[model samples]
Target: MKGKIIFFSVFFLLTTGAISAQAKNAPRSIISTTALIRKYHDQKELSGMQKGELLELYIERIKVLVKTLPYIALVTKPGVTMADLGIPDDSEHKKSLENQALGTSTFLDTTVDFQRKMMPYSDKANLIAAILFYEGTLKSLHEFNELNEM
Candidate 1:
């Protein structure tokens, strides 16, 4: 019984330590374009111009995602007023929403272009990690906006 208890305690501590390490190494909430460009260049052997183009694509994608999130949330959530969702009830908001949606759609279309261009050269694991991080960021943003309405 004593041996079993010690084994379990050691196992639990090791498991928790591994989890904590992984959580610590996870990326920050905001993606840095410069850092990403440097990483792409270093990891993928991308030329300066290629890195610049990739960074531009990334920035454009993120801009669309961030800009559309509030509008998307507003459109989806019932009983939530635009004001409550941080959207103004004006032509400006409508124009912004329209532009953001269009831009986000265009960004999604370019995902294939980016993948075809970079997937062969890029570190697959790093690319996947970056994608997951961005997805998590978007999820967090939506959840935060939703909670604010409550």
Candidate 2:
């Protein structure tokens, strides 16, 4: 009985700590487009905050969009496909998108890691690069919204 109790307690603690860390990393919420526009005066809300915060938000959304892609596929109506989202149904286009996503992910990680190490420094170069990556994420989101009619 004592061993079982200790084992369960350790398991619970580890999982709880992991969950907290995950939540902390996920700073951006899936807020309505209206709220985002109201606050940021734009659809993407990419430049709403200072350099560090903006980078974090962009990274969060990029990861969410990629992760949400599978969910989008599952919920999309039958017979509708990537071609409907203005993407071609071929390897060349698919590979292009994959490359874009990879670049976004890399940019996100590089910015985020740097910002974490040096917070509150809104360097122009970092902001410019972040904005560029953000544009791709915004375009993808617009396509997703168009697909879902949201």
* 10 residues in a row with least lDDT, candidate 2: 29-38
- Residue-wise lDDT of candidate 1 within 74-131, one digit each (tens)? 4433234446556555767656645655765586668756765766576545454454
Give TM-scores for every candidate, taking all chains together and pairing residue i with residue i: 0.35, 0.32
* TM-score, prediction 2: 0.32
Misplaced by over 4 Å in model 1 are 1-97
Q: Candidate 1 has which clashing residue pairs, if any?
A: none
- Which regions of candidate 2 fall more than 4 Å away from where they truly are? 1-81, 120-150
Candidate 1: minimum summed lDDT over ten consecutive residues — where?
29-38
**Which lDDT tens digits does candidate 2 get at residues 1-150?**
999999999999999999999975442321211212112224345445566666555545454444444435433222343465565556775566456556756865786676567644656456646655655655565587687775
For model 2, the local distance difference test gives: 0.53
